[model samples]
Target: MVIRAEDVRRSYGETVALDGVSFSVEAGEVFALIGPNGAGKTTLIRALTGTTDAEGTVELFGAPPTDVARHRIGLLPQEFSPAGRLTARELVAYYAGLYDESRDVDAVLSDVGLEDSAGTWYENLSGGQKRRACVGTALVNDPELLVLDEPTTGIDPTGRRDLWRLVERLADGGTTVLLTTHYMEEAEELADRVGLLADGRLVTLGSPGELVARHGGDSRLVVEAEDEMAASRALESAGYDLLPDERHVAVPVGPEEIPAVVEMLEAADVEYGGLVWRQPSLDDVYVALTGTDVTAGGDPIEGGRP
Candidate 1:
């Protein structure tokens, strides 16, 4: 394992940030730490990078995280404030100088699609442009392990797509990447494994497909019948659970059940609009494990209710 954490715990006075969290990352893989805001993802990253002290075992490449390890780790923090007066090239060169074997500054900028903005001052660039510049700085040292926290937070959709390509390329080059992002699509696209944190706990961990398979259900059958109450009652009698919506009836049935449901609807002559079947997605898995919608929240760091 390139990175490992065992029984990690951190507290901020009265609030427990992380409680007995544990997980590991293998070499040449992309691991995502996903959760609602305030679920301890940042705290966990801090612990792993030795930025914060916590009671636990954190090992990076068989050694404890320290200043030497820091040089080998590329960290793009959630909050970044670059020198406004410095040009993109200058900023990258400054960061490169801190490493023993620094990557070519122009190459790193081009890799992040910032070649055109190399001369632009940090203060003059747009939010997304600045984010790309920040990413370039993180890649300047060619660190073995990359840690990105909300890397795509301020980026636009197009910029996000570009960043995704960069992330994939980095992983393909045998870099172990640990990413934290609120973008479900990004996680779905790049992560080999994802860990969900909730209420200061590592709630679940598995491959994206594994987590989906473990929790995802078949298409949701929504029936809007002429007599909603009667239809709900019929579905209940047939072992379907009642959802919050009164006019809709849902059941976790496979393709075979679809035929039966259709036949029953025809036989009963129930007036209905239509039915929709959606494959269970990562969003559904998040809800199932955390009992809270991923979108129900304030800022990206302050997650929704438990």
Candidate 2:
């Protein structure tokens, strides 16, 4: 195992940040930890990096994450702010000195698509470019494990895809990664396995598809109709199921029942603008297990997100 954490617990006075959480990460695997804000995801990451006090059996690189093991790990913290005055190259070079080693600063910069911005001052870079620079700093040491916390939070879709590709390429080359994200799509797209955390506990753990399958068994058919009530009643009368929403009626149907539901809608002359079938996803899994949306930031699902 690249990471082995068992019964980990952390507390701050009256508040328990991590409550006997346990999980493991295999070498060369991309494992994602997802939870709402204040769910102790950051607390666990801090403990694993040996930056905070905690009670647990935690190991990295098959040993305690001491000075030696720490050197083999690269971290892109959620709140990263490089020195405003330093150029990208200077930032990476400074980190290289910490490892007491020399690295191809240019290569690391280029790997993260930052070669052209090597001379740009860290504070002047765009949000995505700054993120890229931070990533370069993390990679200069060529560590065995990479830990990222919300690595692409503010990046645009195209830049986000580029970063995703880079992370995937790194894993393909035998680097183990552990990440925390609010974006369920990122977890579904990049993770071989995902662990859902809530209120300092490991709620569930499994492959993305397995979690989705375990939590969501029915396909959802969403219809947009001018008269949603009549359409809903027609489907309900025909024994089609209604999901838990009112803006647009969603019917729960199996593969074989899909055609039947469509035909029934047509025959009943229920005017629908469009119909779409949505498969189960990690978003569904999270909502099912936590009873709240990932973007809800630990609030009850009905409490509107801020």
Candidate 3:
């Protein structure tokens, strides 16, 4: 195992941050940690990286994290503040100089898509560009294990997709990756296995497909209606199970049932805006396990479980 934690626990005063969390990450595997804000993700990252002390065993390459050689590990914390006046190339080079042997500074910059902005001053770079530069510094050492905490926070969608490809390439090159992310799709896109944390607990662990199959509820067809009550009555009269709210009605159905549902709506003269068929996803799994729904902006809204 490249990483291992056994019953790790931490607390600040009376507030517990990590309550007996345990998991392992294998060599060359991309493992993702996902949870709401204030769910001890940062604490766990700090513990695993030896930045802070915790009350359990954390091993990197069979040694304590702090005992492992720094040259063998690369880390990008959630909040990293570099010299704002330095150019991206200068910043990455500075980090490369810390190790006895390191990858070429220009090559690291290219790997992170920062080649075009290599000479841009850190203070002047766009948010996405700055983040990519930070990522570049982490990769300069070409460590066997890489840890990223919310690495794509300020990145645009296109930039985020580019970083996803970069991560895939790194994993293909036999680097172990452990990352924490707020974006559900990020975890689903890149993780070999995902461990979900809630209130300082490891609530679920599995591959994205496995978790979705076990807890992602049923696929549903959603109809945005002109009148939700009328549409609900119409669908119920046609023997369709309805999950109705104020603006839309959801029907759990297989692919074969869609045509029949449309016909029933047409026969009843029910007006709707459109139809959307959605399969179960990681977001649904989170909601099912946590009794809270995450918004598009990644904030959790507490709600009753279905």
Candidate topping lDDT: 3
Q: Residues 8-84, candidate 1, lDDT per residue (tens digit)? A: 99887777888999999999999998877777888888889988889989999988898445568899888789999
Per-residue CA lDDT of model 2 for 167-239, tens digit only, reads 9999999999999988888999999999998888999999998998899556788889889889989988998
Please give, for residues 13-76, the per-residue lDDT of candidate 3 as tens digits. 6777889999999999999999877677888999999988899899999999989999899999
Can you list the residue pairs that collide in candidate 1?
37-301, 37-303
Best by TM-score: 3
Model 1, C-alpha of 19: deviation from truth (Å) = 0.2
RMSD for all candidates, in order, please. Answer: 3.9, 3.7, 4.3
Candidate 3: RMSD to truth: 4.3
| Cα distance off (Å), candidate 1, residue 303 | 12
Off by over 4 Å in 2: 245-247, 254-260, 298-306
Q: Candidate 3 at 77: error in angstroms?
A: 0.4
Candidate 3: worst 10 consecutive residues by lDDT?
297-306
- Alpha-carbon shift of residue 299 in model 1 (angstroms): 9.0
Against the hidden true structure, what lDDT does model 1 obtain? Answer: 0.83
